[model samples]
Target: MTQLPSAAPTIATEPGQTEPAFRLVAVAIEARILSGDIQPGDTLPSETNLAETLGVNRSTVREAIRALEQNGFVRRETGRKKLFAAVPQSRDISRRLKTAMVLDHVTFEELWEAMFALEPAAARSAAQRRTDDDLAALDANLAQMRLALHDSDVLTDLDIAFHHLVALATGNRAIQAARLPISELFYPPFLAVISRLNAAERLLFAHEKIVEAIRDQDSRQAQDWMEKHIQDFQRGYELANLDMGTPAALPRAGHDKQ
Candidate 1:
């Protein structure tokens, strides 16, 4: 076990530093985790130990731990007080960005523009990089999608998962990360269109074409199919009489239910 430095610099509450003691403590712990001093799944020191070591109150240590947990740097097991160090997952960070985009009144046009640039490129990369396992996952998603053609809610979820699988197949973390936040915002709106139009079969068809191109390692074909699939989204928006320029919002519960 790599022990924390015994003579760790105590968090200083310098008069003019102005930052809260808990924030300073949180930053210090975060830096240690990022620097690999504390690895994921390693048990973090107790609040008492952390407070004593950092020369802060246990209450401050508690507050810092709460912040760390919320940000995905630390986790506590169910019914347990022991905290574990953890690296933030992409989805964890993406949720915050997703919220900000919604609050900023991000439009469908903006999300569509971003997806237009990312998804096709992701498809191209996936075609070149995908493994047998990636093909299996995509196949499973397609199978489910086919069965759900007339069910908008299920179709909406499958559509998002299908695209996510394609991004994962790319094995490009940058592309995956870039698309993660935009996807929830970009795809859910399609639920409204899916509910309103006879578009589910069209969506399933495009997904099939995209997957077939990916399986054949036809990068250009995959990219082209994905591009058309995305364009169909905008067309669906227009056909449903929804304004693409309107600020995107999360789908209401049961919004996809006919």
Candidate 2:
């Protein structure tokens, strides 16, 4: 008579607890990647190979690959059967954090407070370290802003980009990641308020001052102007009678690009 197969090995956990096979497989593959055994651009082993090497079913390995792909740990080229390794970008992670913040019901007050601490710090850093390229980018933004000041939608996009360029000038990865999402939500409502109150000129003037301070390597001046600029946002919002208690959101429809 044929003998029954041996039972699978077990790990320590609470009674009646069993990790899903796919999850175990995913963890195994993730460990390989993190250990640098699988560098980005290295193609993953075929499902058949993984199943055989890991002593799991092909279906389990397939599911694990799917999970890894979803988490940005694995990427497949178009029209290709092989999956390549990939390091998840800070931007990809920031988008998820932004969604989580919105779901957590974060408000304009919370975002503004965070900006109050972060933007001034970023401006000071940018002032000390900004390059010719950084100044050029800011100048370009201001040029666009000059024409878009009366158009809230165009102004909104440029405003968001202006602050981002400032953050990039600092060359700090941590600060960049910290502000990316908050900045996404920060400007839209405030720009709408600015437009309603016709304070675009004031906003543009502040931006010009801050950029000049950065160009001059004047950290104190940059910090002061950034602080004033952020304060102006709050002031304009109040003047427009918009509620600060409102959730931070994307600004409404902007001018037609045509």
Top-TM-score candidate index: 1
Q: Name model 1 segments beyond 4 Å from true.
A: 5-9, 252-258
Give the per-residue lDDT of model 2 (tens digit) for 69-167.
Answer: 878888888976787877777887877777777767789989998999899999999999999999999999999999987798898889889999999
lDDT of 2 at 54: 63
**Clash count list over all predictions:** 0, 0
lDDT of 2 at 109: 84
Candidate 2 Cα misplacement greater than 4 A, ranges: 1-17, 250-258
C-alpha RMSD by candidate, in order: 3.5, 6.5
Query: Candidate 1, clashing residue pairs?
Result: none
What's the lDDT for residue 143 in model 2? Answer: 100
The model with the greatest lDDT is 1
- In model 2, what is the error at residue 185, expressed in angstroms? 1.6
lDDT (10s digit) by residue, model 1, range 50-77: 8877788899889999999888899999
lDDT of model 1 at position 24: 84
